[model samples]
Target: MKSGMPAPDGIQPARRATIREVADAAGVSRSTASRALTGRGYVAPPVRDRVREIARGLGYVPDATARHLRQQASQSIGVLVSDLSNPFYAGLAAGISQQARKRQYTMMLADDGGSPEVEVEAAEAFVALRVAGVIVTPVSAEVSTYLARQQIPVVEVDRQFSVGVCDAVVVDNENAARRVIHQLLDLGHRRIALVIDEMHWTTGRDRLAGYRGAFAAAGVPLDDSLVVTAGWDVDAARIEAHKLLSRAEPPTAIFAANNVLAEAVWRAAAELNMPIPERLSLVSFDDVSWMSLVRPGVTAVAQDPVALGEAAISQLFERIQSPHAPVRTVLLSATVAARGSTAPPPA
Candidate 1:
């Protein structure tokens, strides 16, 4: 073995410098060295500075796991998001970071990738880490139970529930849907079809309810045949759109539950050679940066995902500070943008 190189695993000599070595070298107690390295407890400013300087000079890196154990806690929050690629969640992540930094906290991020079991696993992992709290966009009701069992304070973002387990910070999904549908109606689109995600999700269900309320107010019969529940993916929505357009009496306009599904509707229209607002009109639930880049520009309901994220972080901290505080359900409103996607239905 080379003299300066690290020895092979399991055959290495056992003379590696320990925490005691660092403390002795720094002329400080072991606890003081630990606190200085991890930036944990209160110590004299001069002693902390001196210990940290010496530890850095000695190329010391403390084991984070060991530090966590010794402290009996971690100064980090766990975040579980379903789809990391979704722009809405990405915006939310940015907001979480903004507020967490303000509170001197860090996040342990977990992207479940839309798997229920993986969501549970992530929650378990967060529990094992002894996080200060959790902010989760739950993929299933099952995750709620798991989080409840862990007894961790949680702030559920972008969805609402009455499970009595955790606080929720969500958008006014029903009102957002209603606003979009009303926009289509004002543009003279009576034959509007609603494309939505699977009803299992709270947002999907609430948006569907909002769609129904809009139709009721507009005096349009709620046609079950015109409503389609696609999986939370563009391809699924595209297939559903194809099937809906294949019908003899196709809708003159479409209302997609979200931006991704809205994109699918756009693609389906192109595939069928249906011109926008000439043969069909469209409206969607969420707006992102790319909304205006599309052909006619997509009309949508825009919500502040970043604000929602910040609210969730704040709510979690509130829960941690006052565990018995009333569990509040916060609903942020959405803005309805009137883009060029909708017009009077063709005669």
Candidate 2:
């Protein structure tokens, strides 16, 4: 029975004060206490104030489970991401968490590692928990349809596989990619190799289109041989870069499609004794911390991942408010952080 001792095996732990206990302490009816705590119905001003103060003094919190059942609205939101190890996804989840907390909702987060099966499983868990809504960087459209069938609202961020079927918050990947390619081309680089993960996702597809668009606009024919399909790992991308750089007629410049590939190409160039912007010019579609910290900073297209997450959560709240409204897509902007990595092709 000592203060620091564990409770007896058969004894139950103390629970938070309930509304009934608060009502007894305040000399008010349970219904009156509920009205005062929720601000949902009228109570005499003085009595309401007195009840609220007593409730606070007793450290009382209403039962969210019971409340959710009565109102059909849960005070928690589910957030699913492709890869928590990636800074982009980490920043995005941080933004979503901040906004969800500010709005007085709990955030349940899950990492799917870019797997469709994992994404769907997380969706199912969210539904089981009765989360008010979900915000996801989805890998497939199946997750959206599954959640929709369960009467759950979803906001897809970064990229979309459910374009017209669900809400999405995304960047204009094409425009950003186009601008970077134009910058390289304007600097007199024609044989520029574009290294990408895959063209299946909207992000990669749009970015590649922009690369091609810039070449077409400048009347420069793109070299098909220079377009390298490097898978999603840093080492694989590095190998692809090494192969491309070792070609008999190597490209004068390389445009990496994302931060992972950017790092890969940067390492490859270093290993091959090619100085950036001297023997090989380099650019990336996404920016990372090392891009700015390296001796010769890498020029990159930067997207605010945090803002993207915040926007996605805001849109999700709006959707919850108007469930029957037409689904819409929000396009965010990205900017180029021009650094020392890009310049005219070597003489």
Candidate 3:
């Protein structure tokens, strides 16, 4: 076949054109052709134009895999979250995607459905892909340790496990929880119940600590019966809430540690025909859309989950750029958005 012409019938189709073919057609060295095409190094304008024209004519496509290998970095990042169905995680993923697009990086997302085993599997897959870095809402320390051992840059978001071993971006869960619980305490809520999901992760652990701290500051002995570990789902929380409300000495106020638990508390109150604040006071550690739209808006710690995602991406890029730098933990602040849900205990 003639140079730059389609293969003749009965002959096997020719392989895709490479830089060598472009260089040959342009009568230039491979390095010069590369410099011209990538606009990286020095090449005369006439030579660059000739090389580009030849590349176009020859259908030469640059190999991104080879280029990434040469640069020792991929153009993609991995993002792992506990649940994408939750608006909180969805917002976080959006923030990460926005920042990644701005930086000319692609994101590979993995949802582990709140399972620690699944989380570890996702981390292993990311490592196998040789992603530039990872941002994860970790379920277990094993995933973080595995990534760190592989010399991968990792940034823990929302929840952290590898403290002092990796970068982290999280809100001040304990302080925010303490502040909101203190608001309820100041309103004369003595028998307040704390509804929580998982206590193994920092998100739940810190919030629980803050709850205890608030009661301690007031010199009130904690009643173990008032603390409810309602699994991770709204249904589980609802059942636990029913049990709490059925008790003869039921709590007059409820502090839900997350949006899901908050929703369960609200539903349980509704089913029991309990009037909020008048019959039972309610507060939540995380706010959601329905919280504000409801008749009596829930009192909650309003955290910027989107901002948290952005911050996690920023930290991951920093870690990728400076792998040997000292590990850093960024703690953001959440504010209480008090509405009509919380009030003094009923007489």
Model number with the top lDDT: 2
C-alpha lDDT (0 to 100) for residue 212 of candidate 2: 94
Worst 10 residues of 2 by lDDT: 4-13
Alpha-carbon deviation at 153 in model 1, angstroms: 1.2
For residue 108, give model 3's deviation from the true position in Å.
1.1
Give lDDT per model, in order. Answer: 0.85, 0.92, 0.91
RMSD of each: 3.4, 2.5, 4.4
Task: Arrange candidates by lDDT, descending.
Answer: 2, 3, 1
TM for every model, in the order presented, reads 0.88, 0.93, 0.90
Instruction: Give the Å error, residue 170, model 3.
Output: 1.3
Residues 1-347, candidate 1: write the lDDT tens digits: 66876556746535655678889988989988887776778888898888878777767777666767877767799999988799999999999988888887889999999887998899999998889898888877767677767888888888754356789998888898888888777777777898888775689988998988998999978778888988788888898998898899999999888878888888999999999868889888888777789878888898878988988998889999998988888878989887888889999
**Candidate 2 vs candidate 3, TM-score winner:** 2
Once superposed on the true structure, which residue ranges of model 2 sit more than 4 Å away at CA? 1-13
Off by over 4 Å in 3: 1-30, 50-61
Q: Which structure is stronger by lDDT: 1 or 2?
A: 2
The all-Cα superposition gives candidate 3 an RMSD in Å to the true structure of 4.4
Candidates ranked, most accurate by TM-score first: 2, 3, 1
Q: Score residue 196 of candidate 3 by CA lDDT.
A: 93
